[model samples]
Target: MIEQFLTSYFVKNGEHLEVPPKYISDTIKQYTVAKQTARTYRNVSFLKVGQLTKTKPSQELINYKFTKNAKRKLTEDFSTIQSWIKEGWIIEEIVFAQDGRTAKAIHYRIGPSLKYYFDAQNEQQTQRLENYVLQLQKSADIQPIKELLQAVQQLNEFVAMPIEKLAHTTKLTPHWSIEKRLRFLHFSIGFFQLANEGVLFDFKEIGATLFDKIGGSKAFDRDQKEFIEELERVFSVQTIDCGLISLGKITPVFFTGELMGHLAIIDKVLFMH
Candidate 1:
């Protein structure tokens, strides 16, 4: 579901998925599915209308692939050439520059092979199908994953707010990488869990940062208290004895916790150079 969540995050409210079909393929591989479902597709569908007229004269010579994937070898489907011939005549087997670089590809024009592939009977339907791919590319994205990590760093730099305050002040978007952000949120959740038990205030009787004083400076209202109660149920964390806790786990022990969370969060998303 993380993959679906990430894919939907990019698409926003669109019907078609993004282009570079490989991204979708890669994302799908992350989830549980039959291996064949992920691996069983023609690598690339390179479509180009061949310019030379002497061969087919009336036919358009094009690669068997309607989509081009740079990583896929043009050779894997060379056997498919026979399959193509089953439906259409092979005008030529040649190597030509695709995107202006020399690459081996089979080019054939409109014929029985392509007829079923792209129904000539319905021209408008074919055009819409092409437009759909173009729109899909604009939909799914990877930038937000990067953006979230940067945003969290900025928030931590300034102030230490409660969970609700943090969410109110910062934007945390969910996607496949959402678990990355959730890890950061979870670290604070442990502290709030401690606070609910009054362990923070109890330890502070000796000495501690002001933030751990819960109802001290940034006090918790009834609604916020209810939130932590829910968070407890959601994460299913248990309360531990404050006497058994380390000083670093309690402060305003939050700075150390936040720091740890941030470092762990960075690793989960894009790796830091």
Candidate 2:
């Protein structure tokens, strides 16, 4: 009967034996049997070797050592082991030994929760997750222009003031105001009443006068006509399509989309007056 019980309960495929024959024999001897029962207890020894045959022979049993802190949190029993296994603990094997008159077994294997707990506690993994979340939050804070435009449909006072101030504070030359400059010429030359009403100007006379005024013929060059044309386009009272005039001559010449009028000092005084 002892042999059958050992065979049924003590050994199975993939199961680890927990307790040596000496311990099993001692346990049976303590059962307060009759003096004649010593032989029967001794007979149970043969059953132990057969029980060992049922267990996985190649796999060795493993024992785990835990620090005091870890041991406090990992206090466990048979039910705890069963629960852990049910929750995915991988039971590699079990260790069996005999201590004095008692048979003892200690489960030894890696549990899935143990791995998960350590992974969660790892500093590197925690820092990585924190950095990822911080980056996501920073990205979320950046407002897309279209989305910003959608918010607060009408420009608020706070938004408008800075733009207005910027426009006012920006420095610009006195010459840039087109409204303050004249765009039409309606002057009479003595009694002749020459309207000379366009961007027309005599480049030869202007260049000669400029050289005489500045006392340098080198100052007057072939590009005088082109420069005058550009000056007219930039600061004169007439458009480019307007014909040219040779200041007191009657030929009424037209600039071939090239010559322009210059903004003279007299013109500036006239504008100011």
Candidate 3:
């Protein structure tokens, strides 16, 4: 699915069979795609046969192995994976030998980098989503999230607390605490936003600890990584760069009366359910 999307992205924008590298960034964001991890693909190829057009590359056969239950979903958003970019693997420049005898033109676009959380959607549709979020805030099924906030209020070691300690202290198994699978997708929006603001220093870590992917999800699901990607695409969410701030003085969040009240609204309405 992801490979197909990547292929179509260029084709849709191309006036001819081949697309220039200039369109990659905008095309990726338009589709809400994150990272393109699929290895082999016909980055740019000419079609020999087509149902509609024989000359257009739109009908080209993509050289991809479609497998069952592949992790094809666009998971990550605009990534700060500087390493991939530095190594030039994110967008590899490959040269295909012409007729397997001489060098031909090179293809420089094959992968993606960023996709927005909610991009180019109609206002009414987005409003409906916002209303759904409001509904979730008041939902009764959010006991676990509410309970986690209460636990954090009492525990000074909330962010840095060990998962085992949290489970023991809360009288719940780590397994029980995990929001089942894709729930992490819709669920962590506020948390990611807060994390982006550097308010939830341990938000990502605590999230990972809670949902460690035990025995795979019962249904098709996405993990914290996917959730983070989706959230970051919409909002500028990222971890605290330790170099920017002093880590030695990193103390726990003091949960006092006013603080608890503030956290209650944030944790309950923003993060829960």
Error of 2 at 205 (Å): 77
Q: How well is each residue in 104-200 modelled by candidate 3, as lDDT tens digits?
A: 4422332332111112223455565455444434331222333244322322232233433433443222353323312433344334323334333
Best by TM-score: 1
Ranking by lDDT: 1, 3, 2
For all predicted structures, in order, the TM-scores are 0.20, 0.18, 0.18
**Model 3: residues with Cα > 4 Å off, grouped in runs:** 1-135, 138-185, 190-200, 203-222, 241-273
Of the two candidates 1 and 2, the one with more favorable lDDT, higher being better, is: 1
Give the alpha carbon lDDT tens digit for every residue of 181-268 in model 2: 1111001010011112223444344334323455332333434444444434433323223333443333544546655556456733
Model 3: lowest-lDDT 10 consecutive positions: 49-58
Give the CA lDDT, 0 to 100, for residue 239 in model 1.
Answer: 26
RMSD to true structure for each model, in Å: 22.9, 33.6, 21.8
Per-residue lDDT tens digits of candidate 1, residues 34-116?
11134342122233111111222122324443322112233425545443333342322223342323445644433323433
Error of 2 at 208 (Å): 76
